[model samples]
Target: MIKSIGTDLVKLERIKEIGIEKFAERILSPKESVVFKTITNELRKLTFLAGRFAAKEALFKCFKKGDLTANYKDFEILNDENGAPYIESKYTKELISHITITHTEEFAIAFIVLEYAEYK
Candidate 1:
């Protein structure tokens, strides 16, 4: 069952001026490291990191039961074999049902569906 949906858009140019590597270091996971490594443009890097930040916040909002301020490092979004993003957390895996993520040049969006499943 689809519990909730959230989406966000970020300005590509805004991130560029700030430096992409800094933004990537702050947001992107170890798996996403490669994505930024090859992206030469600073703005594209910022756009990517901004999108990821938004995706993490969106997933947190959709979580069934938890304090909004709770530290959730495990909740960081990671790319799958196909480059699709998914939440990786022992807590979320047990509480969440499923999720989907998408992005464009100007924005990145993520939808989280809460569910009851065994934690892998």
Candidate 2:
């Protein structure tokens, strides 16, 4: 069953102004940071950073993080062999998550769907 849905939009220019390297380190998990460092193109790297930020923000909207606070690092996103992005985190063991991210010349947008299932 569908548990929740969330979406987030981010301006690419805003990401640029903040400096991709600084933003990437702040939001990207250690594994993500390693892949990000290998990218040779500035635009692709920026887009990657923006997409990750938007994705984390969207995922944050899917559930509450309790009274402690929200930590972007809690959600880790990675791409598969086909270049499809997927979520990897200890927090999502019982939930199924679907996400899609897109970027234009000026913005990055992400949509997320969270689902719950029972073992048969």
Candidate 3:
């Protein structure tokens, strides 16, 4: 069964203005921070930061009503060998989550779907 859905859109320029290092330190998990630092292109770096920011916002919206407490550092977004993004969090063990992130030159957008399976 589906539990919740969340979506967020962020402006690339806004992320750019915030400064990548500061924003990454504030928002990205330690693992994500490493990836952010490895990117060589300026625009790609901004887009990457914006995408992660939007994704985290979307994930927070998914469980904001629950008793769970979340912070940007609590969740890490990781990619598989094929570059498929997935959430790695101790807080979401019982819930299954799917994330999709995309970006244009001006904006980065993300959508998260959370679900839980019924057990007999």
Candidate 4:
């Protein structure tokens, strides 16, 4: 069953001015940072960071107040063998989360749908 839906948009130019390095440290999980570091292209890295930031922001909107207290690092966005993005959140392991991310040259946007099993 669906519990909540959340979406966020971020401007790439704002992230560029802020510097991906600074925001990456603030927003990315350790595992995510490692992956971010592997991208050699600066534009790709910036887009990646923006998408992740928007993703986490969207994920944050999925919860009710007091559902949990979480920082950006607690939400790890990862890919499957098929390269489909997913949210890996230890705090919400019992709940299913679907994520989609996309970017234009100027902006990055992400959406998340939080779902629950019948048990929840």
TM-score of each: 0.65, 0.93, 0.92, 0.93
How does candidate 3 fare on TM-score?
Answer: 0.92
**Please, what are the lDDT tens digits per residue for candidate 3 over residues 41-118?**
988888888999999899888887656667888989889899999999887778888899999999999999988845
In model 2, state the lDDT of residue 61: 81
Residues 84-105 of candidate 4: C-alpha lDDT, one tens digit per residue: 8998877678887889999999
CA deviation > 4 Å runs, candidate 1: 1-6, 41-44, 68-73, 118-120
Question: What digit string (tens of lDDT, one per residue) describes model 2 on residues 5-119?
Answer: 8899999999899998999989999889989999999999999999999999888888855444658787888999998899987666788888999999889999998898562
Stretches off by above 4 angstroms in model 4 are none
The most accurate candidate by lDDT is 4
- Estimate every model's Cα lDDT from 0 to 1: 0.63, 0.87, 0.87, 0.89
TM-score of 4: 0.93
Rank the candidate models, highest TM-score first: 4, 2, 3, 1
Over all chains combined, what TM-score does candidate 1 have? 0.65
User: Which clashing pairs does model 1 show?
Assistant: 96-115, 97-115
Give, for candidate 2, the lowest lDDT window spanning 10 residues: 63-72
